[model samples]
Target chain A: MENNLCIAGFGGQGVMTFGKLLATAVCDNTDYNVTFFPSYGAEQRGGTANCYLIISDREIGTPMSDILDDLVVLNQPSYDKFVSKLKMGGRLFVNSSIVKPTSDRSDIQIISVPATDIVVGMGNIKVLNIFMLGVYIGYTEIVPSESIWKSIMEKMAGKPSLVELNKNAFEQGIELGRSQK
Target chain B: MAKVLMKGCEAIAEAAVRAGCRFFAGYPITPQNEIPEYFSKRMPEVGGAFVQGESEVASVNMVYGAAAGGTRAMTSSSSPGISLKSEGISYAAAARIPMVYVNVCRGGPGVGVIQPAQTDYLQATKASGNGGFRMRVFAPATVQEAVNMTYKAFDYADMDRNPVLILSDGVVGTMMEPVELPPMKSDDEIERIKESKKKISCIGHPLGERVWIKPGVWDTIMWENINKDAEKLYESWADQAEWESFMTDDAEVIVTGYGIAGRIARSAVEIARGQGLKVGLIRPKTVYPFPYKAYEMIDYSKVKAILDVEMSIPALFLEDVKAAVKERCPISTYLRSGGNLVSREEMVSRIKKLASR
Candidate 1:
């Protein structure tokens, strides 16, 4: 099976980091092939930032795709720009605190999580992306949740406080995601 | 060592370091900035020298000096930046300096865009500089292949005592994938490599036995001889021509490309195969040698049409493909230029149309 995912948001929203974390986790833990490609250049300076992540059982082809099996949008502009690229029956994960889908698309599934508000409530906004990652994993179960936690630990290895905060945020996201399921 | 996930540009830098590259001087350019950025951090760890040259020309010339002093040196830049470095490249080629460089190409005739494009095909294979000198150009489709080619590029340059090119583009440079890196050359090995070239390098020797190395030869006969030797060296690279043929045994349509375009075409071939279309792919791993034999070996009896896929407007790589095919079958082209990428769905549709015809 192959899944093409695009994560998009404002430049400082950690869109690329989210994709990288997932891609790295899958690559380091499983035999699945993965590729992470970012939208770069002038557009990345205070503008919209996005990245593509492809995870496949077979060798991946192009890292960029016109159509996506899944799209994660953290802001309204990202949702407005990329929502059309999602295929019918594809999954759309959105940050409910910032993005409100104006279109009533019946063919796709929209999973809205109040990620920004939830992270703010947790007293640290930096873990917002990691929390969304947890939500994605909890819903899809594409890989084990422990794999993601292990990846988070590895990425946040140097800072003990940040690790604890991110772990708490991720667990909260997983609980919310499981409830949605 | 186990595999690790790395961006293409970073992987290329690490591969160069592992290959005993001790000196790197390059200017930063978008889509390939990571290469220089990587070297800035990595070179120090390897006990090597890294310089952020004031300009691309200076960077390339710095590499020329380093390589002339018997060090494994390299430089990288995007398309327009590479144009500025052409003079230095020509000098290195003329003086027979064994050095390696990379063109992480962006769209351009002149600063076109920062997105990936295969528009530099002609510039790389036909005319990298004014001297009309040729270099072994490796076009890798995947990060793994990029790492492998970069690891071997130093060896190729040293073997021929000439410059080498890794012709990559923005797509390949920015993408990240898992790759098994080559083993690092030990300090002793690096020292031995430098010692091997001591006699020919610019190291000081007795005045009576001094060796002069200059790109220019005032005598016409001497320049002609240098050109003749370069031609012979290029000719000897026939055995190094490499290409990948996928399911072409019974294919009625053959698709061909190099670099990332070639990679996307391979995927199209697989998708078309699932649809029961007899489509195959010929992906050239080395663009300079052109892999003419791979085209020559195509069974004319089975193949009806050849589809040349590339990301260049007028198709710069088409000339090489045409020369190799020798007009055996009708050649069609599917092109996307100026930072636009060729998609698998489009290629698959094109192959189906050719197959139906």
Candidate 2:
């Protein structure tokens, strides 16, 4: 089985970090082959930054895929730009706090989470991406929750307070996603 | 060592460090900045020197100086930056200084898009500089292969006493993958490797014992002999030609590429196989030597057409492919240029069309 995902947003929305965390979690814990590729260059200077992550039971081919199984957009521009690339019955995870996206396509599923608002309520707005990650993982069950948490801790190792806030944000987001399902 | 996730540029840098590279000098450029960035932090830890030169020209010259002094040295840059370093590379080649440099290629004839491209084939293999000097060039398809090739490139440079090139593209430079890094060469091992080159190195020998090494020979006959000796060295590299032949034993149509293009083509070959097509792949690991023997070994009686896939406008690598095939079968090309990658779907469809024909 193979899963191709594209995460896109403005420069500081943690699009690349979101992909990197999930890729790292999958690569470190499982024997599955994974590749993480970022859209670099001018798109990174306050423009729409995006990244591609591929996870496969077998070896992965090209890291850049025209069709995606999942797409997480943190803004409306990213949603508008990338929604057409999603495959039929693919999932779209949107940060509803910043983007109110309406799509004409009916074949794909759209899941909206107010990740920014939720993280702000949790007292740290910076964990919005982590919260979104939790929702994606909780809904998809693509990988173990513990693995994502472990990766988060490893990433936020030196900052104890940030780690705690991120942990709460992630767990709460996971509950919200599970409640929906 | 356990597999760790690393960006391709960072992995190449670490591999070079483990390979006992003690001196690194480079200038920053898009798509390949991580190479010099990683080396800047890494070299100091290994008790090596890292110089962020004022320009590509200066950076490559610094590497030339380090290599001449028997230090394992390296430099890296993208397309236009590499063009700037060509003269330095040629000088090193003429002086027979052992060093490794990488061209993490960007799309360009001149300062094209900062996206990945395979546009430097002829420049790397044919005219690196004015001297018509040749170097062993390795084009790895994956991050692991990038690490392995970079680690081995230093050895090849030392063995041949010539500069070596790692021709990578933007995708391979910026993408991240899980890699098993090579073991670090201990300090003593690094010292011994340096010491092995002391006799020929310009590290200030005692008076009257110095062997002056220069990149130029003024005497006409002496230069001719030097060129002749370089020709022999280039000829000997045929044995070092490396390639991967997949499912080619009875393939009716053969697909071939180098670097990331080769890697994608391999996937396309597998996809074609799943659909029950008689397609296979020939991936060149060493582009400079061109792996002509691999093409010559193709069973012409069974093969119908040869498909050459690359990310160059007019297909620079096609020349080598043509020379290898030698008119035994018609050759077709599937090309995507200007930083666009050749997708697996396109290649699979092309392979199907060729197999049907």
Candidate 3:
């Protein structure tokens, strides 16, 4: 199976980091072929940032694709810009706290999570992306929870305290995602 | 060996380190900024040196001096930055210094968009420097190939005493993927590698016996013989050039491309074949050696036409493909530029149309 995903948001939303964690987890924990391509330079300063990730059982032809099997939009502009590119039966996960997706498509699946509120309630807004990743894993199960947990630990190597905070956030996200049908 | 997931630029830098690259000097440019960035941290850890030069010209000259001193040296830049280094590159070629350089090309005739494009094919292969010096240019379609080719580039450079170019675009340089990284050379191995260059290097020799003293450039005949010998070395690479042919055994129409464009074209050919069209692909891995012989392997009687695909407006690779085919069959081009990729659907449609006729 091939999963072509686009995660987009403002540069401060950690879109690139979220994508990297997912790609690296797949690389470190599975035999799956994965690629992550990010938008950087001037775009990273204040403009919208996005990352295209492809996880496949076969060799990936290219890292960039206009057709997304899944799209995660953290802000309204990202939702507006990328909503049109989602495949008919594709899945879209949005941040309900900041983005109110206006797309009227019934064929695709939409899962809205209050990720910002979830992380803010946990007293650490920096763990927002990690929490969103938990929701993604909960819905798709494309990557195992154990793999992501281990990846999170490895990624946050130096700061032991932040690791615990992110783990808590991720678990909450998974719980929220599991409740959404 | 175990594999690690890394971006293409970081992997290329790490691979060069493993190949005993002890010195690196480069200016920062988008898409390739990571090469020098990675080396800045990595070089120190490996007991090597990294220098962020003031400009591309200074960076390449620093590499020229390092490589002349018998260290495995490297530099990297994008299109406009590479243009600035051209003169220094020519001096390296004229001095016969073995070094490695990377051009993570972006869309450009000038300071173009900081996105992937193969517009520099002619600049890299046909005219890398002002003296018409030809480097053995490797264009990798994937990150793994990028790693493997980069690890091997230093050897090719030292063996031939010429600059070796890794011709990658921003897409390949910036993309992340899994790679089986090669083993790092130990400190002793690095010293040995440096010591192995004693015969041609002026590092240890007295000033009286140095290359500058013996052949100090007032002699026009010596320069003529040097150019003649350089031409001969370039000609010998024809025997070692590399290319890949896919589904060509029964193909009636052939598609050709290089680098990432070639990778995209292969997918289009596969899709066309699934739809009962006899399409094949010929992808040249080495752009300089040009792999002209690969075209001769095609069965001209059955093949209908050749389609050249690229992400350049004027289609730079098409020139070499035409030169190789030498009018054996008709040729067509599908091109895109300014950060646009030629879509697989577009190529498949073109191939189907060609097959029907």
The lowest-lDDT stretch of 10 consecutive residues in candidate 3 chain B is B207-216
The weakest ten consecutive residues by lDDT in model 2 chain A span: A38-47
Q: Please write out the lDDT profile of model 2 over residues B138-217, one tens digit for every residue.
A: 99899999999999999999999999999999999999999999999999999899889988798778998996668997
Q: What is every candidate's C-alpha DockQ against the true complex, given to 2 decimals?
A: 0.79, 0.79, 0.65
TM-score of each: 0.98, 0.98, 0.96
Distance (Å) between predicted and true CA of B152, model 2?
Answer: 0.5
What is the per-residue lDDT of model 3 for residues B1-357, given as tens digits with 9 covering 90 to 100?
878889999999999999999999999989899999999999999889999999999999999999988999999999999999998888888888899999999999999888889989999998887867889999999999999999999999999999999999888899899999998888898888888997778678776776541222668998789989999999899889898999988888899999999988887898798899999999999998989989989999988888999999988899889899999899989999998877887899999888877
Q: Give the interface RMSD of each candidate.
A: 0.8, 0.8, 1.5
Task: In model 3, state the lDDT of residue B221.
Answer: 97
Per-residue CA lDDT of model 3 for A92-161, tens digit only, reads 9999999987878888899999888878899988888999998998889899988988888898999887
- Which of the predicted structures, 2 or 3, would earn the higher lDDT when compared with the native? 2
lDDT of 1: 0.92
Tens digit per residue, CA lDDT, model 1, B1-357? 668999999999999999999999999889899999999999999899999999999999999999999999999999999999999999999999999999999898898999999999999999999978999999999999999999999999999999999999998999999999999999999999999998879876878887677899899999999899999999999888999999998999999999999998988898999999999999999998889989988998898899999999988899998998888899999999878899988999999999998
In candidate 1 chain A, where is summed lDDT lowest over 10 consecutive residues?
A: A38-47
TM-score of 1: 0.98
